[model samples]
Target: TRMRPLMRGGAQERGRRAGTENVPGIAGFGAAALEARSNLEARTAHFLQLRSRLEDGLDEIENVKIIAREAPRAPHISSFIVKGVRAESLALNLDLKGFAVGTGSACASGALEPSHVLGAMGYSASEAKSALRVSFGVQNTEAEVDEFLAALREMTNRNGTLSGRSTSHFTL
Candidate 1:
């Protein structure tokens, strides 16, 4: 696995990355990693709080369903489907509103096909079509989440009403 690749010295990294030695990047990454490890508990709590707020907001809106709600998820990510809206359109509208978001999967952004992740999880074509992903970073705050929710509500409501239709629901 890439995350647990054979332990190698700096020289091996240099060879693989094709750089003499990115001392600064390595040092910075190491520091960030340490900080992340140390702050894991607090960071996780904050993320869960924000995620809960986002989910609550989405619940009040019509035709929005939280995908993988019962599944174990990372602290910083939220994926959902907004009925009657396409993921691409939602992403574009959010971008225009100065909020960065992802649709389907990053790798499948430009493709017309539905997300493989959703398909693998048994979402139908229309359900997958309405997918959107929001990943929060350390810099994100409650105010930012509120703002995003407002923007999403406006965009989705203005577009059309959400249809609560699910072709299939299954766990993978």
Candidate 2:
């Protein structure tokens, strides 16, 4: 005779997951996924536009260089290097000013290791260490970009003098 459905079920196979189901969390996840799917295209376009403006603002700053400027990059990600300042220091200063930024890859933060991505793309250790990453979200605006750039310029100038190194001048 065939086994009963409940009896045939493995001990580890309680519904879809091995552990107890989280009904509320699962429902929330489904709702979030649906909303994300609905807004995906429009959100992506907005991010791309913000990223473009951010890049333009950064490019106009003296002594700042963008990594992989010529390469195909994600529309929402902007990575750059400010001449003569450490990435960690820049990130910290930016944080104090209420703008959150990252140094190199998010995974490599606090590791004191240079970015492997920059290394693979032929950036020197110093160049990679000077890198900053700004990921644009749908909520960012042109005014925010301008404010960030102003803060970045002031911080870079201060750090450059303190470090006693010439500002990085990169052309691609």
Highest-scoring model, lDDT: 1
Tens digits of per-residue lDDT, candidate 1, 23-129, equal 89999999999998999999899888888888889888778889999999887888888877777767766776688777775456656889877888889888888
Tens digit of per-residue lDDT, candidate 2, span 1-172: 7444443333555342345557999999999999999999998898778778888988777768888877887878888887767877777667767788878765566567898878888888888898888987677787888888787777665435323233221000
- With candidate 2 superimposed using the best TM-score fit, by how many Å does residue 5's alpha carbon deviate from the native? 22
Which segments of model 1 are wrong by more than 4 Å?
1-28, 158-172
Off by over 4 Å in 2: 1-20, 158-172
- TM-score, each model? 0.75, 0.76
What lDDT score is found at residue 36 in candidate 1?
85
RMSD of each: 7.9, 7.3
Instruction: Give the backbone clash total of model 2.
Output: 0
